[model samples]
Target: MVTKESWSMSIWPMAPWKITFLIYQREKLLWIGIQMKVAAGAAKGLEYLHETADPPVIYRDFKASNILLDAEFNPKLSDFGLAKLVQLGIKTHVSTRVMGTYGYCAPEYALTGQLTSKSDVYSFGVVFLEIITGRRVIDNSRPTEEQNLVTWASPLLKDRKKFDLLADPLLEGNYPQKGLHQALAVAAMCLQEEAATRPLMSDVVTALEYLATNKDAGQGGILEEPEEGEEDHIEADS
Candidate 1:
């Protein structure tokens, strides 16, 4: 007979999951600059996992819900149950069981069992799209053409003229258009069908870092800072 023991741990005491749908639904929580910050933070976290770990770890499941936000809105990654450690060897990719959220998994990983850091990159691209568009990865309630976010948005991402159509309406056209283009370009590269073509997490981190730093660049000549006493923790969607 085999014996098993289970332990429960509270990963997030007061912080909440950083689901873009919930964050954008709130009136004052969605800001272009803030979104950039969140993206950069998440990228840095993934970069650390891919590059700093003793034997690099592949975050098999990377999505908006897996990202958590503290009271200050700082992002942190959670749910390491599905994480896999890469062995120190000459192997280029790890072969494993296919597992992850439906709309966020990489096509190759979903079809085959091959897992790589790039799989996480693809999932990050989906979440990055969600943050930009303020939409869910898969929303059946939406119109037929708009039901699947990536399917509808991917074609439009390449054309700068159509970039505005993909932005979150809640932004009210207040974001820097140039920044939007740059961010979308990063997302597009990450979403590449070929896993080998996708940039490394370190590269992704650099791109997002630039976006976060220059968020105010094209903001129609008006850049306003948050008020001193404003609430930091916005209400989550029901």
Candidate 2:
């Protein structure tokens, strides 16, 4: 859990992630550059929690809804209710009851009740994929094959020719194709089912920082409305 001191600090300067969704709803656009910025900033935040913190931390809840942005759109991670401290050199994971938002949870953690920094990495990958695709982590309204964003995107992630298909259709070809490939590559690394295979958050931060600096990463994406179908998939903590 987040310490009392950490809890006492203010987090009021920025817009919440949900507000970002509202903005997209009104303007029909969320820039690819902006997405990269958010991803990089959030990655740095997680890097600190995982590598630079005194004891290291597992940001057990690292989903889009938990991120906030300042007026300049710099991202801040919030809600540490699910955060866990790690004793580096002592153990590899924190054994505990499984918890976290379903669609964003790492498969290993969700199945084994073992939490690690890499679990946060997986969650970050899901959010990154959401940024690139403009799709929710899970949306039941989509066709069955497409409901789980990760599973649906897995095959396309491997084929260079189908990379474009993984991009948000709402981007409408505005983003730099090369940058999209790099961003997706980072996401693919983090989404590796084997926790040990995921890159450390510091490495993820480095890659994302470089991606964010590319001037041609391009402009905007519209948030498409989900088509009519069964109830939307839940993202409730479990």
Candidate 3:
């Protein structure tokens, strides 16, 4: 038998997707700094679930629609229907029926029905990419070549020279190049085809916090090149 609990959370005026849709209607992207803050808050929440909870929880469904935004755009995670508590002990992963929104589920979990904290990390990465590119995870309206955000952007993400192409056109070339590089690096790590290679939510939080702080400080520079290993992997995969 399963039990459920209900608790109150202050109302959030919108979900990230709703906000994105609104901005899209205006042909604009959310300010990069605000995007960073939202990403940080969402990462912190996932970090708490995966690390601070008594029995670490795996948020099996993590996506933009599940992230609520207050009037000020602070992000709060919602919908725990697919959440699962990891059993205490040495088990590193929970074997379960594969369930989650497509285009967001980690490749490993989607293929093998294995669940872990990294599964959530992969979903977070997809949302992060959406925030950066101002595109949906899967948009069939786009040209067939660009319909799947990850499949289309994965190659672009590897080359610093092509990083500019990955930014949302709505940003109007206003975002900091250095910050874009850093953010893409973090996203690439989280979206690794090998789930084991994804960073922990805690590390993701720290990286995003730094980006948010630096963005507020008005930092700007040429984007850094990806590491040799990353470049090689991307090329090989492509």
- lDDT per residue for candidate 1 within 118-175, as digits (tens), equals 9999999999898878888999999999998899998897677787787677767655
Candidate 1 displacement at residue 160 in angstroms:
2.1
- Model 2 — which ten-residue stretch has the worst lDDT? 229-238
Ranking by TM-score: 2, 1, 3
- Name the regions of candidate 3 deviating beyond 4 angstroms: 1-32, 94-96, 215-238
lDDT (0-100) at residue 127 of candidate 3?
Answer: 92
Identify the leading candidate in terms of TM-score: 2
Residues 129-219 of candidate 2: C-alpha lDDT, one tens digit per residue: 9888878888899999999989999998877778879877666654566667778889999999999999999899888877666443332
Candidate 3: Cα lDDT at 30? 40
Candidate 2 versus the native: TM-score? Answer: 0.83
Q: Residue 133, candidate 3: how far off, in angstroms?
A: 0.3
- Per-candidate TM equals 0.82, 0.83, 0.81
Model 2: CA > 4 A from native: 1-32, 216-238
Least accurate stretch of 10 residues (summed lDDT) in model 3? 215-224
